[model samples]
Target: MKYQFFWITVLLIFSLSACKSIQEKANDQFLSGQYQYAINSYSQILENEPDNLEANQAVAESYRLSNRVEQAGPYYEKLVEEEPTFENVYRLGLSLKAQQKPAEAKAAFEKAKGYTQNETYLAETQRQIEAINLSEGIEDYFPNYELVNYTELNTAGADYAPVISENFMYFTSGRRASGIYPADGSPYTKLFRTRAEGLRVDVGNIQTLPEFQNEEGLNQAAIAISPDGNTIIYARGNSTSPKDLPETALFASYFRGAGFTQPIWLPVNEDETWWNSTPAFSPDGEELYFASNRPGGFGGIDLYKATKLANGDFGNAVNLGPNVNTPGNELFPRMTADGKFFFSSDGHPGYGKLDLFVAEKGADGNQVIKNLGENFNSPSDDFGIFFSNYPKEGFISSNREGGAGDDDIYFFEDKTPKPKIVNVLLNVFTKQRVAGEPDAVLEQARVVLYDSSNDQEGGDFSNSNGRVRFTLEPNADFTIIASKGGYFSKSIPYTTRGKTPNPEDLIQEVTNITLDTTIVLDQLILDKSIVLENIYYDLDKADIRPDAAVELDKLVQILKDNPSIKIELSSHTDDRSSDEYNQDLSQRRAQSAVDYIVSQGISADRLVAKGYGESQLIIENATTEEEHQTNRRTEFKVIEIQE
Candidate 1:
């Protein structure tokens, strides 16, 4: 027994020693910023101890830092299922969303929502859910862009973020001849410049900048040029050696005849440890845009704008605010020469990780951010965008399926042939219902149009001709409400489905298509009973049926539309049951209906329930069932008009 015990103890000791060795190595690699090596080292520990929380967390973070969050889903799921902590679950949701599993991601986010008291985390969770909803069916709309991979400019490594100034195009590429980076297992990246005409570039002429900017043992990428092509800034750092401290920040250089000046680290990066990259200059060169993960940001990384101070220095970096930044990373911000702003974000709710979007001035002059939709965004990382024209042509970078490298540059043009616009105008005529005569035009009636989502589109008062007109967009559903003083309001549903002329069919540059409709409002008359149809109770029962509830909802709407009107709800019975019993049952039914209306937000003080049993039957002597049904009825009429 002693010999057997000794052998088992030796084996156990060997296994534990191996696991400790691997754990120590992984921790070393993780702290030194070699996440890929750390991932492999930590994974070995997981093979022996799958529930090792430290190993699991490091491995998942490694994948995210390497820009492969799509592959971190399984590890994140394991972490969340084991711990169910807010951070774990929230990260799991992001991983799932990066994997294009939005539904599962949304559920994970909702679960994480219940576990946090942090306002920022809670707001981020809700934003993620909204993003999932906003991204649903995002591709089923009109597509306007046509993209082409610039094959001559690509290599087997990543080649992305192209910017043009004067006659040269500058970009970052991983084709630099060097040892592979341990983080992503790719060669070190450097900024390269080449002669180019729009989408056509001379790859043979490509060359790196001075050795100062393309320093050894660092990854220099994401280059941008100033409007005059005299100033250049690029993101640099992320040491290739474990002995060096790791960082990513912006560095700038200015033109000096044949060669540029020695690259100087920009002062806009106030914190060295905070991650700042993707620098861009505004068209006027008065403002600089970049992405950072500094403190007080709403997300993992946010876009910031820094204004140029006097004497040619930049400072006072300001976050783009919540309108343009969300709970996820926002990167690669750029502006066009024509004043249109664009950027890439994972927070804005789009096709997948890092989709392209644009921010513009709305009708109210507020910032309006809109997704570029499926045309420019894909189910993969699509970012590093620049536009040569205002809204027509641009170049974008992505790692989508057909790309030649990790992230390839593609030229895109708005090839949606400019369509002959057809104006769709809806004119509404408001008329009053006159007793025993044709309806008369009603002036000064309020008409409002709402879209399918119940958002008000337009509103106007009827003019001297009793007409209200609204311009309609193509393929929309609308609700038109007409209201006038001392009259019952009315709502009409309108649709323009299948009514738009196809672009191919339109010949004129502009076409006017007009449609007309009429709305008739009833003049309120006191004590005139309006029968509430389809409100029937079971025989001898006083409970309100589901059908009766449906009819009462109409009365509830009427009460809401005319706030100053009060009504009396009456119930009647046939001359079949005993007078006393019939009176009690009828009164109960009327009260049940009144209770239902009250439940729908109508005030009880504005309603009165009355029962007229066999004492006041509509049919004095009912013989057939139809006559009984007519006699046994419920109705409501205006009793008091406070207006």
Candidate 2:
């Protein structure tokens, strides 16, 4: 439900004329969020008193509130050019930003900065500039992700705020229900759900969640379920009644064996205030994060987290502080498993209305906030993101373009390269040498991944499905090694080298790739040669560059893992240089790599360096630079293995 209140300065059109009743009615309409009606009334007053300051301002504000931002641009432009008040220039900047003319909006903010003596206004203008820069550079925020509309779950009314539990996808909707909300004439919002197939939900089989519909006429929305899927907390708002007074509160329900228990008032809600709603629980169930317009907030609606006491009640709600909450409404706080905090805010520089943002502490322990970018956001509201598991695949709610109704749900996955990852699945198997023989699943196999670039190692055992899962970083080369007691160990290397964002995508989003790979293991054999690719040195130089170090580190790790194996480290050069010079340079390159591996704690006695100098060329008579580059290589062969 849309709350009725002025986000900007409230206007009171005081006139000493007989038409004061008309002006009062217009002010009442604007305050009640009836912007179109307010526009008509204000325009009638402006026809007679064209120069009336109150009437002109009210008309401009109405045009803005009704999402007709372009219509309000001229009035603000005129107002600022005449007497540039902070409110006029700031609102003008917003109008320009809404119209996609961010350059003009930035300029308007600059002008507003000069006109205001208040520090809050100055800081807000700077934030608007930051928002414009972020808007222009969206790929930086979200790198490699695709968003798909939840066509199955959406209706012709409003369908949003999807939460996943077991096989069901729970959400809130205002479709053709039994009763209509007097405030908006839409059907009263109710809890609904359907079957979930991974990220794709089965919309053809939608049904209402029967437990919470006992209330005759109320709007239900913004639900959060515990990780264990036992308890549910949702927002319930009554229809606009003289007794209800447009108030909303959070309610908690326990999941019984068959159905949900009777919902009762959540302890953190305040009865006097009408703005409390949209409750979310932390993953650990230790804290509750909720939105409220209670007194002493930054402004509008601010997010507050309450501690769950030992007595099963909540303690005093604490504001999330300026780090998360802003003067604009900060609603829908969802915490990921990795401690990332996701929320929606209009106060931040956004596309328009409300935009989804994620915040987390970086390695340096400072809070890092970023928008989800244009793919997940639009000119309207986008909030209520549900992660199946953080940094993997999940769903989000949006009232963006080309939707089935006012608000629709969308699914998104992480596509960017990172050091830490989530939701990566691998299938482990072993192949027999006999032709046409099917590979057998390698259950109970030990799978270990060594990140050569970062020197991190993680291991997991293959399950009954021959599946092993892991979270990985995207910025490194990984050596995936799999082994079982009776089978020979095999190793394969994978790199994220070519998975970087395109130049245009740099400002838009990070790329997330969902991988389902089969790792084939061969029986162990002696005298096997493992060639390391992309370990090239500069012409006439034996020093390693950053890229070469990444590959060389893999060799270092291989030597460290098979500590009892003595190996020969060899280097080959293209035939361009003279044999003496090439041999000498190649020897130095081999020695240099051996020394580097020894620096990483590999035993020096177990290694030998040799210069092949094109003697063992894989491609003889190579004419192209590509072929010549391939001839310049490095390899390590196991000469001896101690039992």
Candidate 3:
């Protein structure tokens, strides 16, 4: 019995000493930020003592920090099952949740509540339940589209920005075959075209543009095609030519039967100085909208528009206004088939980096822009949105995981409900009375209406008589503002709500308004900036009401005398809704305004419609109705005047 006791003591001492050595090693590794190594050490200890709670928990924690949720699940489950402690179970639930097993996570959290009797843990479990509920209906947002095929084109270092037309797919690539050497003699990025055969899903017969090849340091991106696909406009960066600096000017070239014609630069008038690129053409091919970083703009890069005169010259570029251009960078403007605008932005709050967005005209002619949410966007960069109207197919490029390459092209069919039409009319009033005319008749007096809900959507002007009318979609609200060159701007508020229909229904109405001429005349004489009342909108809608029309008529008059004047119609809205909803509504509102003007005899080609949505809200917060109202509005600025 004495000998047996002596052997047992020795064995006990060796076992305890081994554990201490292992623990010390793990502590050193964990404190040094060697998480993986620490995990290995803790795992070794847990193997010796299966119920070593501390060691098991540490293993789970290290796995989580490494973003290896799948690897941590078993250990967390074991820790929680063996000891139903609040900390153990709570952490175990988190691990399950990270692995996307919300049901199992909720169950684990519920079990934990019994162990600690802590209200905080119970409350957290309820929150998790709510989040799971919200995620339940999420699958509907992802449409069912067949992945035709995934083909490895060339072993290009970085290939992206694939845009498809009738028979060709245009893209930018940094590949050795591009023949464009980088500044350091490496492969530089260049534009390439390939035949897109019957949607085979593989790039075929890739060819490079000779004119854009082998440049030392120039980078070209964001290409836009004309409606007829005869002209191409793209952004060229790092240009040595001084003329290219001031106006990120867009160049144009006709398509000869054989190939593209020599490129010619299109410069904006000297008055509007800025860096402009990423040109998007209207369906009629008479207007061009592009991104610019210019002074007097809201901030960052804003979208601007210019019209092509009968003489084949583009008029001066006009800023899209505060609604569409925010302090954030708004880029990749593309016009949809129904005349709405779409783009991408990082400034707007979204699921992640540079999600896709849409802007539309509201009944009051304002731009309302919004972000497309999680179903389409991920934590990675989601951008380069393009859609084909007839077949109703589109493509988006993303750098998210589980893609074919670093950046993969995702094809989708728009399954979300379409926008509804909501319309409003307004009567204009001015302080100065015209001789032999009623107070309403301000000849050529401009009235501007903004869809306060979605700024990127609604933007319009009045006719010869100070009267304006526009349309908007349902599920939105707006603010109205009216202004003349020598008159103060006037404002009003409105709202709309209802379940959106399959194809949104259109609503119409009218309101009468009067402007204070004293404020306008005084500010003009003093050369002080006239402060226009801010407009507002609901979560995602861009419809205008009678109140919005009053402001739109003021803008109409501004365009009449400046017959040489060309302006960009911009819309904006608040940030309370899903990005896709806001984008679609904003776009509809913008198109609604352009439609109204064309009906009133403004050349259909003269006015341009652009939507920035919530990406360009004037007010940062929407805590109050007033602040929300400030975010929704529409406005216009002169881009050019033909002498």
Model 2 C-alpha lDDT per residue in residues 413-507, reported as the tens digit of each score: 87766433322333334332323676766678888878886464778888877877655555457777777653456677766555544434444
For every candidate structure, what is the RMSD over all alpha carbons to the true structure, in angstroms? Answer: 17.2, 15.1, 27.9
TM-score of 2: 0.60
lDDT values, one for every candidate: 0.86, 0.77, 0.61
The number of residue pairs in model 2 that clash at the backbone is: 26
Question: What digit string (tens of lDDT, one per residue) describes model 3 on residues 1-643?
Answer: 9999999999999999988989998877666445677887887987778788788877777776544555678887887678767877776766666555767877877777787756755766665555545544433223544322133553324455667766677776666443332122224466777777434454546777553343434556667777788888776554434444533455666777888776666665233355667777877888887877767776667878889888766677788776666555677777776767777765554443455766777788877665655667665567776664433566677766666555566666645454343333334333444336544444444445456543644444555644555454445665555556654344555444442342322342322222222111111222221222433344445555455555555555545434555666776667888677777777777777666666566786668777767887777867998787677666665444445
Badly placed stretches (over 4 Å) of model 3 are: 1-156, 177-187, 210-216, 239-249, 256-259, 269-274, 361-367, 389-391, 403-407, 414-643
Tell how far residue 157 is off in model 2, in angstroms: 2.7
Clash number for each model: 0, 26, 92
Superposed by TM-score, candidate 1 places the C-alpha of residue 68 at a distance from the truth, in angstroms, of 1.9
Residue 192, candidate 2: alpha-carbon lDDT: 83
Across 561-612, the per-residue lDDT of candidate 1 in tens digits comes to: 7888999999988988899999998899999899999999999999999987
Cα error, residue 468 of model 3, in Å, equals 52
Clashing residue pairs, backbone N/CA/C < 3 A, model 1: none
**After superposition, which runs of candidate 2 have C-alpha atoms over 4 Å from their true positions?**
1-25, 31-56, 59-84, 140-142, 177-188, 214-218, 256-258, 413-643
